[model samples]
Target: MEWLDWFNDSIAYVEEQLTNEIVLEEAARRAKCSTYHYQRMFSYIAGVTLGEYIRRRKMSLAGVDLQQGQKVIEVAAKYGYESPTAFNRVFKTVHGITPQEAKKDGAKLTSYPMLTFAITVKGVHAVEYQLIEKEAFYVTGLGLALGKDMEENQQKIPEFWNEVAAAGRVQELLPIMDGNSPGVLGINLMTKEVQEKWEYVIGVASKEVPIGFKQYKIPAAKWAVFSGEGPMPYSIQDLAKQVFTEWLPTSGFEYAELPDMEVYLDNNPTDAKFQIWLPVRLKRA
Candidate 1:
């Protein structure tokens, strides 16, 4: 309940600050979380970026202002837009009409109401996971920079792995996996500078990388490792959704700000078991 309370309060704070310049750090502070973790969690649960959500809410309010006979320039400035053209472009994107049209009688303007966080109890699936601690380790292999489009990245990632396997890169890199973690891993490294993209590494745990291979060291930390069975991708993807929506809010843990990991147990992912490891720390008392 405290988790939901904090998150709802954070959303309320964002709504209150919509007319002013919103500082994400302040929003995170109100929620008692790091900006990165806050943004990541918000995107997963709310299905939009924080900036995008704010933009929509602002435009929604602008539509109301226009309907109430407010001038275009005044409404634009009130919502933090520099010029009427810039405001009209975004306003149309949301409401599908210009600000001038919004002022006319019986104009149907879109609305994005204030949001509140809550948990719904219904048909729940069993989630399998364990809390494990590990020492610092390294993964050595090839890496790719993936854009922020999660749907696109999902398709591109499997293709990258397939290419690696087809070219015998797996066998070439398997020898280097003589470290603590078992099997090869798909690592997602979130770049702080670029929130819209992340670095994906297909590698194995190793202390020393082979020549012409990239290596990344994972810091020692506590992890909540989740397991999924059945078919490739679908099962894992379903489990990931459950982790964020069902398990995480009630797990009493916060993200540890480290690269998340996925461990592959079998060479073939078609119908094998795999694990998703999330770096986390127990919530403070």
Candidate 2:
């Protein structure tokens, strides 16, 4: 099956076995992709991490059962929780109430329904892109260790950028170049692990001249570049997500095992434009 079909199949499996213990690794195995890639794709497309979705779905069902006069322990057991206490802890964390309280007061709670996939055909928006084949370029910027939770990383990235700026290292480390493209840049580095660690750089691209800054050489490769005009960081990130979820699977291209780079065209956060370069190789039919 194609990669997009594999992703849809994985989502179907998750929906079918909502009440079962859905291990991420097992889900990735079924999809024939690494856990890191699976989780990243899930979050990019679904707008929520897999673990968060599961917890919300479980809690939503538990809330319904509680309202239906089912015992808390019974609902807990049905959802694969070993004990009511465990269920209660998770429920409180997600819904901000215990099972008993939710049952007695009919408190408001969050729900995460099963996801359904559909393709919508629309008029093409002009996407400014180029297939660039360039020699290796050295990139240097801030590097930090990311935790296992992808959601945590998403929330922390903006702050990380601010911290980099506050330290005044961005000025010294990543100097703006005199070119048509000049602005903040982000470089993501990944490894082969289920909970992969990534380093994000919120700096500008430079051809040369820098010390006390980490350097990474991006090898010569085919790149699909997409540009967007909007607010900084968020717009860049949205484009990245769309590339992984919408472009790669449908474009008949397989992603290369190399770091992706985002170059900020204009660095001002309020009025920013950026471009993303995704490394890919055409799949052999």
Candidate 3:
């Protein structure tokens, strides 16, 4: 099946299980993808976290149930809320009113329509990328543990970079970059799954570990190196999203189980040409 079709089928399964205790793993299984990848892709493409999507969907349904004269407690129980109070709070947050208000005459109830995945032709421009293979290499520099919370991670990362700059360490690390891949890298290594801690490294490719710097080895593998030219973050993010949503589904390659690297071409943070290196391998026939 096409990736988009499989994704929509998984979403349909989610909708069917909304009233029951939904198993995210089962949903991902239906999509023939890992739960981690599925959640990440869903958040990127849907513009909402998987948890948020499920919550909003449940609240939307609760509003409908209340409007149909179902008891608030019954609706809450059906949606797996422990109590009507908890349900009301969530319902109000999503629909802008309490469940009781939703049942009132002419009360506007919010509806979260079932979500389906479809590929739209992004015809304006094509992404520029190249496939390359390399031997094992090392990246060495300062690293920090970033928490699972996406919003907090986004805010904290820039501040982390600023702190590194303030310490004047970039100059210290650059001269020692003797590896084949020539550039400082912003690497995110997924260390844990349940709590989802990302170990972020600001490092350059190197052969040996430099003093006072941590080193991570980049394993030998085939990589899809996607380049984008623009200002910080926005351009890189757009390019990455295109890669996951548009390219990966149809590329006949699967994400390799390796740490991805972001290569910053210049020191200018505002306008830099950067490349996102995604490790990939051809799918089995």
Q: On residues 101-123, what C-alpha lDDT tens digit does candidate 2 reach at each position?
A: 88876478767677765565532
Q: After superposition, how far is residue 63 of candidate 2 from its true place, in Å?
A: 2.7
Candidate 1, 156: how far from true, in Å? 11
Deviation of model 3 at 45, angstroms: 2.9
lDDT, candidate 3, 1-285, per-residue tens: 377787898889889989998887788777766565677678778988777788889988888788889998899999999878898899898988888898998999778888888777763767677999988877888888875445456577789889998999888888888756788788767523223556778999886676788887767879999988788778888888889887886788987756778898887768888999988889756
* Segments in model 2 whose C-alpha atoms lie over 4 Å from true places: 13-21, 64-97, 104-111, 175-183, 193-197, 202-211
Q: Candidate 1 residues 132-213, lDDT tens each? A: 8888887888988876444556578889988988998878987767755677789877635224457889888887777878
lDDT, residue 191, model 2: 40
The whole-model lDDT of each prediction reads 0.81, 0.72, 0.80
| Local error of candidate 2 at residue 230 (angstroms) | 1.9
Question: C-alpha displacement of 90 in model 2, angstroms?
Answer: 4.7
- TM-score versus the correct structure, for each prediction: 0.77, 0.78, 0.81
User: Best TM-score goes to which candidate?
Assistant: 3
Model 1 error, position 60 (Å): 0.8
